[model samples]
Target chain A: MSCIIERLAIVGVGLIGGSFARALRQAGAVRHVVGIGRSRANLEHALSQGIVDEISFNATEGVAGAQLVFISIPVCSISAMVGAIAPSLAPGCIVTDGGSVKAEIVRECEKLIPEGCHFVGGHPIAGTENSGASASFATLYQGKRCILTPTERTDREAYETVARLWRVAGANVCSMDPERHDRILAEISHLPHAVAYALVHAVGTADAEGENVLSYSAGGFRDFTRIASSDPVMWRDIALMNRRALLASIDGFSASLAELRRRIDSGDSPGLAEFFTIAKQFRDGIL
Target chain B: MSCIIERLAIVGVGLIGGSFARALRQAGAVRHVVGIGRSRANLEHALSQGIVDEISFNATEGVAGAQLVFISIPVCSISAMVGAIAPSLAPGCIVTDGGSVKAEIVRECEKLIPEGCHFVGGHPIAGTENSGASASFATLYQGKRCILTPTERTDREAYETVARLWRVAGANVCSMDPERHDRILAEISHLPHAVAYALVHAVGTADAEGENVLSYSAGGFRDFTRIASSDPVMWRDIALMNRRALLASIDGFSASLAELRRRIDSGDSPGLAEFFTIAKQFRDGIL
Candidate 1:
């Protein structure tokens, strides 16, 4: 479908936000794109790079005439942004977010949202290490999955509108329970970051040999370092917000680790072999 | 030096071994590169692809008159091959290996080594998921470190020869104690593999809703799965042979994981923030 929406407004002109605008426009999914952000420089940059047809620092004016509004701010600011634009949303406008955590965002917005506006939670699982408008490319969302978590109060029309937009941008849309989404991602995404960060410290910390360990950290440690190099503030907020689920994943990992330790201490070669072999089987199934 | 060595022998035609041959040939490090393997098809393929100047299925025949011998077979088979070649190695021949663990191979070879053949354990800190000769690339060693663990018994001339050859092939060479090498790599390399495998199986062994969890395994779970997709036999042998150091690394990781769990359970916001912030600092040091 060409020009599924007449206007698409993206609030936050960072990597994810700029990428969505660029991809939609290049794919002909939206006729006109509007960019909104707290940073005047970012908005100007987005407009100059053709990521948006219009630029507005004022949140209300940005969404005034838009059919689709995407709140692409960091997780910590999702609630405030939802509240800021809730009062001025165009009639029957659809609102979705690209935040990592959904339950909290959904819960905060559900109670204060304006009537007739659909608030469907969305997270497009497409990104790169680079950030900002210059780093964004038009094909960033091709073949990636976008998850839509709609609540009971969410309008069906709003959900479909967001799904259609994602589909036109070359994303496969899937539905999930918000709570389950948070928990599953805690194990897969958040825990890896936490573990990688800890491992980085463990290697770089004050070993008697100084940076000898860190100097030789290129083996497998380099990969861990990249994941650990993510934005500190973003990861800090994720760990604090998803504390419960992150804890559950850590517990599961600890139990598995403890079992390994017991076998090692007892010199159980057969047991260790069995454990590693089974683990190999499970990972093999994924690929 | 346009060409340093007149002849070089690589004992296995796997990714690392084949890549070493390719890089050496591409850089004119060695004039004649010989590949030795048990698989007839692999030996023929290596010859046809110009990965080696010659192919020999017999270990003794492979090392005869060769100035440099590289043992690139699996860890378990390292000792037997060393024994087979020790009796036939040319006088003043220098030998090195691409194995992950250093101490075991050093210990096994030190017992049966003949005079004038020196064993300097080497670990090239590079590779990909793909294996075998066809997957080999010439730039595999570019900008990577190659750690050499040489004991007091190692001949100075032999050590320098190995270092110079690795340097010629585009690797930064450094020296470390074999025992220390095992411990350091256990944390940076071995334990990560173990944890990746365990995380995969941990999700698999979860309760009745495990299928749903597996389906959503694309996020960061895919990263763990990618690492765990490593050769099962190779990993199993590593876990079994390097039992002492691998287990110790697991203990260290377990402690860190437990601390994360405790902070999450108690809702210790400061603790979580401090932990993540400290990790960020360490990760930044690497970059």
Candidate 2:
């Protein structure tokens, strides 16, 4: 496993990509890392921090001759970035991503990738509300789950190579169908973000004697809405790319909430108690 | 503030009551604390830990000759417990609480207390998801906000006395109308709890290729659902007492969620970004 990757190209060198580069560097698993991003200041900072061996504003030039390319950016832009840099990828180069939604992105990447190259959809189920290269650390992915979504046509050798990188970064890699990954993430991750953001919005706008409700928030309120402070553009793209599943999740949550409201409105004490009891049990069951 | 309270009676003796007694004792503000609750095991544990000077199961006997009484039980039982202890309270005894919902509890307790004894509705805006005497700590209320809700009929001297106790425990005390407190709490605290519980229930029950979504939850999911593990019976009582305001909050949250759904469903990227941007700003505004 000594320098298994000769050269690695990281597009959108933000939190996810910078962390991947740093983790791989720390493990001595990757050599000659090329960081490509829209932010010159960020790329320079990453270079100064020794997170990347080289930097480029042009994805095509950056990815040229790279054995592996990791696309970590907004979900909406991943496919276009892949398309823009496709011709520059080496014949045996494998491309993967750190995108949240997988189905559409994987489909689009598969369609755009060169015939001899490969595309794998990967999502590391790890992050804080903070984003950017400055917010990343070498241990960000330690013991975290990284789900790789591969369709039937995906090249097995390329998939294994990509999985090795995540494994080397201390992540436990698992596989799921592209669509299944999208659906699960929509429920497990996207819906919770939406719920948090909406709760904050509703509470912030609520008035009590003209006092904003959020001003008096305590620890519980702050913890519940912590995810609401995440990168808005990244989440917006995630919501759109995973629209149908997210919509369904929202409906499911709305129904659950409506049932709670009904029980409370009807003064059904037993029913309310039962709902909260089940919720508590289920919440406690999450690892 | 040397032993301002000669004897303090505490009902429920759970996290809130136990913490109150411990904090008061730490401040040397209460000479003796009588811990009253339905659970003999918990009462004995509280007494053993010196959280309460004595333990009692009889509410009437618990408050006899006590200068201050703090009821920190489930909201639904606050009035009945106050009634049972009302005749036993000495003249000028001040009865307060750590209930989340205030208007209804205050009204009910104000009616049940004896003439010489005063009822002051107070809510210490602090707690953990854990409950019972074991979860209590001496500094639980330090630097926390304690909102005292008093009506026009509330005794000024009794209210001041209760405020002094909270201040001695290192709490910043403020006064508000009972109904206003209920509305504000419903939006700030109750709604977030409801959202967390509903989100967890919805995700835990969701199927992804026959897999449970909660199994793959990350740190964000765990943080978002932490409040859902709060005491079920306690939340059930709060939900019932704060029914009207919580119902409105549910509707408000539903509307906010609907707007997000509309933006995502319509593929309005700018709108979705704006929505998330505003939410992030608002959430960041909270301490």
Candidate 3:
């Protein structure tokens, strides 16, 4: 495939940004990749690792003259990044983000977007607990889902361009309303993380005698708590940024758990069995 | 590596019983294996697959002259099996069970154990979502932990013999009080299963429009809900047999989750981050 953009500026080059850059480079979809971040050492490392063609410490200067700008940062910092780079972007520059929570970013960044430039809220549902440029690879987004939240005011040409970029990188692109995206993600992603964190805390704190109960954990506990080992700051920002939807998800899950608890307390073996049977059917249909 | 027992009888030829028989046969630990079950097809399948040397539909007749008896069935049915075989077992025969919950089994079976015979409670901390004889394998118990719960009245020689049986099958043998074993297992194993079931049901039931939300779940959701696909009947029995400890675990988990919900509702980003950091640290320390 031919290069889709003359210059691609990636702000906050970590796992998501670094992986996008690498994937774009491998697909020959971007001619030059410019990385922008606060840490000079990380930017230098990204340059040395060949994930980015160049590195810059200034977001405004880094985004100048770039036809495509990808903001890959925490959900809390995305709005600030948009505000910082809005003044320096070219008139026709297309700006997109890799934020987990979409509604806040779309609401805040859409208002600050400069005239003639396009801003589309995007989220790539592909990542691991590991972060940093060194943890990135070219095939990270292969066969994964990338959601684009484009409004009526979004430039159709810009949306197509961003969608094509993700497609070239081997991702299935789908579009939805920003609010709907956040609500769905709350149920699928954020709620699971909350449950994982709570589970680990419950078991860890239960060891009053420091018995190290985790040592006896088998495959089930290990797999269930794997997400609890994710990045704390990122999850914290996610939980806060999507607070309303996340709170609703917690309420829903709490109700289900309460029902299960009541059944167990009543010694209603048939009810418990029926609950598990339905859960098993649903779980088997997931994939 | 020679045959450790002259004859062994497996009262339930399912995953656990069949695997135990296969592992013992592979290790040359038992000269003859007798398979007994209600399903004649499963017994025939076990016999054809070489998992057992003989097949019998009668538990009492199958265990009449055996030196070792292993009851691998649901927790609720274990006491009945002991009663059925108690009248026909030979003297000095060592009998053990592979049940998830131990307290109830030990408390009930110890009374019906014939004089000169021994009953020890055993739980093998190894299994998959699959069951039946077709899923049995010789390496299922290799490198896994097999816990034995013995009380003050347990025969020293019989306990040593059961421990040796599992050790010969390449398992790490450990002993604990029956109540203590049930408590620890409730925290690590049973609670995780409960949480998984609730999570799946929460998401599965939330799709009021039948949007098939689970089709969009990522790796985290998949791994977190893996245990939800486990057998419903077995888990139902476990929930009822170990009700008190599981209820306590559910209460602890609910408290942790409620605290997290409060922090999310208050938009306490720092508190949420601290919670995740502690959870990550605990999860990382698990093994």
* lDDT by residue (tens digit), candidate 2, B1-287: 58889899998889998998998899899998999888889999998899998988889988889999899999989998888877788998899999999988889988988888899999999999999999999899999999999898899899889999999887999989999899899999999898888887788777434776778888988998999999999999999989998999899989999988899999999999999999999988775
Rank list by TM-score? 2, 3, 1
- The segments of candidate 3 whose C-alpha lies over 4 angstroms from its true place after superposition are none
- Stretches of model 1 off by over 4 angstroms after superposition: A28-34, A53-62, A132-135, A206-209, A262-274, B1-7, B26-34, B53-57, B204-208, B219-225
TM-score of every candidate relative to the true structure: 0.89, 0.98, 0.98
Candidate 1 residue lDDT tens string, A1-287: 56788988998878888888887888888899889987777788888889999999899888998888898877878888889888888888888888888889889888767888778898887765456667777777788888888878888888998898788778899988789789877766777677776666565553434436665666455564567666666676777778888877777766776786676667676776777777777766666
Which 10-residue span in candidate 1 chain A carries the lowest summed lDDT?
Answer: A202-211
Residue B90 lDDT in model 3? 96
Reproduced native contacts, each prediction: 0.47, 0.86, 0.88
Better of 2 and 3 by lDDT: 3
Could you tell which candidate, 1 or 3, scores higher by TM-score? 3
Q: What is the C-alpha RMSD of each candidate to the true structure, in Å?
A: 3.1, 1.3, 1.2
How good is the docking of model 3, as DockQ?
A: 0.86
What fraction of the genuine interface contacts, i.e. the true contacts, does candidate 2 reproduce?
A: 0.86
lDDT of each: 0.79, 0.90, 0.92
**What's the distance in Å from true for residue B184, model 2?**
0.5
